[model samples]
Target: RKMKGMENLYTLHQEMGNILLSHVLIVRENSKLEKAMTQINDLEVRFKDVQCLDTSHWSNPAPSMIQQLHCQIQLAKIITQGALVRNEFRGAHYKPEFDLNQPKDFDPHEHVDFLEKQHYGEVQENEFPPGHLAYMKRFEECNKRWLNTTIAEYKNHRPEISFEAVNTSLVQPRPRKYD
Candidate 1:
């Protein structure tokens, strides 16, 4: 109870282990992802039992730790889902199922409608910034297909992802080449 301290939370984090590291992570097949996600998801369910032990809101660290853990779970899900959906091998996003030189991942005008419809950028200037879109922000190759941006809305404990348009009316996107 109150004497539990943060050992339980620390143990939970340790349980996640290396699955939390997204960078330099290489997984060829979906089954690997399936297993990792299953563990993380199961961790989420088990997290409910995580003994905060210290419920003292004043100068208490348990609440913050729990909040961070919750956010981590959500982010893990986002990364997994994005990796699952994208069928191409563009930039750092790689799926062994697709060729190294596959087609571009995004459509330049993909999210224009969603952006305009939502009248975005009105959120707290701090949290999401008025001009920034929200829910989830992903970093993919910025090519013509990605002229705007993509968004993911986590609704009803699930993520409903969509794209938002970028105001590229002034300048045009050209072929991006490093050679």
Candidate 2:
């Protein structure tokens, strides 16, 4: 039984490699590999036999599960073909194929800017809520400290001047300044 299990595992790995190589080839020759990729994705979703909360005997399968199974079957048929396929590094699977050490063009202020924009959108023009401004100011002041504090440090000594506490204060009619 153990030997059979090992053989099955080995076979699965070989099949996976073959499928990947075939996908790479199809992608190289025909630019329209989206359909093929979609099918492969579908097959993967169905092949996964995990009994999640929605799929358990106690609970019925969701409507989406049927659609997922349909996609898996369609993709499996195309991937099993033995045709000579081209190989090229492209798409999500080829992440490690590119330069690993290159730093991402990250803007730390992007999230803050987005939050501010979202807040602005929610409020009417020239109708700046005093509470909103207070909250924003408090956020800006604590933002640096919040970023610097590690999860371990936070768990050990819960920060008195925390975002949650500050937000709760702001929601009230008269906000109290944290000591």
**Model 2 misplaced stretches (Cα beyond 4 Å):** 1-15, 21-106, 122-179
Tens-digit lDDT track for model 1 on 14-112?
777666553215544566666667777887787777778677668988778888988887877776665555554444445666543312443334334
Q: Please report how far candidate 2 places residue 85 from its true position, in Å.
A: 22
**Overall local distance difference test of candidate 2:** 0.36
List TM-score per model, in order.
Answer: 0.56, 0.20
Clashing pairs in 1: 108-145, 111-164, 111-165, 112-165, 121-130, 148-166
lDDT of 1: 0.56
Clashing pairs in 2: 25-86, 43-72
lDDT (Cα atoms) of all candidates against the true structure: 0.56, 0.36
Can you write out model 2's per-residue Cα lDDT over 41-130, one digit (the tens) per residue? 544544444222343445555324544544434444443321112121222222222212211332334334535665678533333433
